[model samples]
Target: MDPRSEELAALNALGMLESDEKRVLDGSSLVDRELRDLNAELELVAAELGRLVVPVEPPADMKRRIRAKIRSRGGSKLRSISPLALIAGVGWAAAVALALASIWLWRERASLNQQFNSLREAIAPVTQPTAEKEEKEKPPARNLEEELKKLRGDFESQKTALNTEIEALRKREADANAKVAQLVQEAQAQKERDAAMKLHVATLQSEIWEYRRSVMTIVWDASKDQGALMLDKMPRVESGRDYQLWIIDPQKPDPVSGGVLAVDDKGTAKTTFKSTEDVGDAVKFIVSVEKKGGVPKKEGEVVLKEP
Candidate 1:
């Protein structure tokens, strides 16, 4: 049986398969005996889980919500963008990196034009021009400027989408954590290993830059032994310098490197980083400005950290 069929079977058992996925699984299960048996077993497991876990009651306003949704169905639906898409498209959606690059390029081109005009003025004094260089470049410059404007708009839209996704992810994580906490307490003795896993989330704001606001957030997934760092309104690092993250474990004496950051000019970055050593229940997280690639140990100026 195909592995895809196996997954669809489990989702079907839980009544979570979409209409299209249900069709695929139904067709596959007809021909795949192993997949059929797997589905049957999973359906039993789902039934048992349903019996063991208390079901949550629907909201009192569910009917009102349904009616509102029905009325809103006439309007075009908005697509839910994933934050991970920003990570993958890192540069363009990457704090609208292409927008920044394009702006930089536009400025450089404009500077070159100014220099060309100055040189032309210097030459025209010595020689009478038979033909003038018509302003043929003006149209291209205008088009480029228009493109930059569109990119800026796109950047704002992507930023808003990222913010919404981050909030939704946090809410889902909170719900899952609450549920897991209850289950861990109830079955700690039976499954101490699983119960030991944990997650940490912290938000830090800086006051050093009095003019602008800066925010940093870290989400530590203890089970995965990794963490993600998100920054906004941060100050751009100086030339030949980069921002680095440090994970401080109480068991260790020094902070471990959690990878160098690539922040855009506007002081925004999002990256997943890990330490050289195990981050067993991190005590704290620190951000600092380091040389180009980062150092083995934190020998840079500490800029932000958790209280």
Candidate 2:
């Protein structure tokens, strides 16, 4: 028998090469080397097919009936497979879509996590205290209590020093106020001295005016016996400088001065005088250089005298 036919008979006997395998055999067009290799492999397959006893031949009519049954089963099986295949294909497509969505979500989550970390870093300085504060909170490696005590002592010392300086400043301000008061008193005294000097000057001027008015009323006439009542020419003087006359009595201890008189541009002084005593021979008139106020004593050379 052909090894392929023998192997098919063995597979039929073992119930492994079922109606589907027979249908495959019926549709195949394998030949030559391919057929020979298939037949050799079939022999080996047949050797392992030992579950049932082999029959020499299936009846020709039975083969026909079996082929008809296989066809019918194939059609029904194709119908059965259609819904499951459709469901499996849809399940696979949904699984692939879910996997892609999950991957996209994972990537986006990673990106968001990176952004969150960046924002956290950016806001850290504003949200947290400075490094100096952290160092203050952290205890020193050694002598923590001692260092804190030292700092407290230093702070107290600085506070005391500031208070002392403030007190010294207050004292300096008091000293300045005392000096200002003394200066004010001195200024008041100086103003009083100036006022007193001005009053004295006004009194002296009044006295000089009263003395001159009294002297101008003293009148004396030149006697005809006294060299024909001679009048002489007067000397010239500079601006604001003038000559004055004095009256002296040989009988009195001090001379009585007369009113001040200045010569006009023509160098002439005319005066009318009166005397209490009738005799004018005892009084003599003397001319001397003087300032506008008249001198208390005779100054410069005597310019003229009447005796």
Q: How many residue pairs clash in each candidate?
A: 0, 2
Whole-model alpha-carbon lDDT for candidate 1: 0.71
Clashing pairs in 2: 219-273, 219-274
Model 1 RMSD, rounded to 1 decimal: 31.1
Model 1 C-alpha lDDT per residue in residues 1-307, reported as the tens digit of each score? 5444566778899999766447545644544467779999999989988677778989999999998987788455333444444334443454565567568767866876676577668767786665443354356567656766776787678677776766676666677678889988878765565445465655554546641365566767677778776776678788899888888888888998888988898777878877688867756888888999999889988888776
Tell me each candidate's TM-score: 0.37, 0.23
CA lDDT of every candidate: 0.71, 0.49
* Top of the candidates by lDDT: 1
Q: How far in Å is the alpha carbon of 250 misplaced in model 1? A: 1.6
Q: Pick the candidate with the highest TM-score.
A: 1
Q: Candidate 1's error at 193, in angstroms?
A: 12
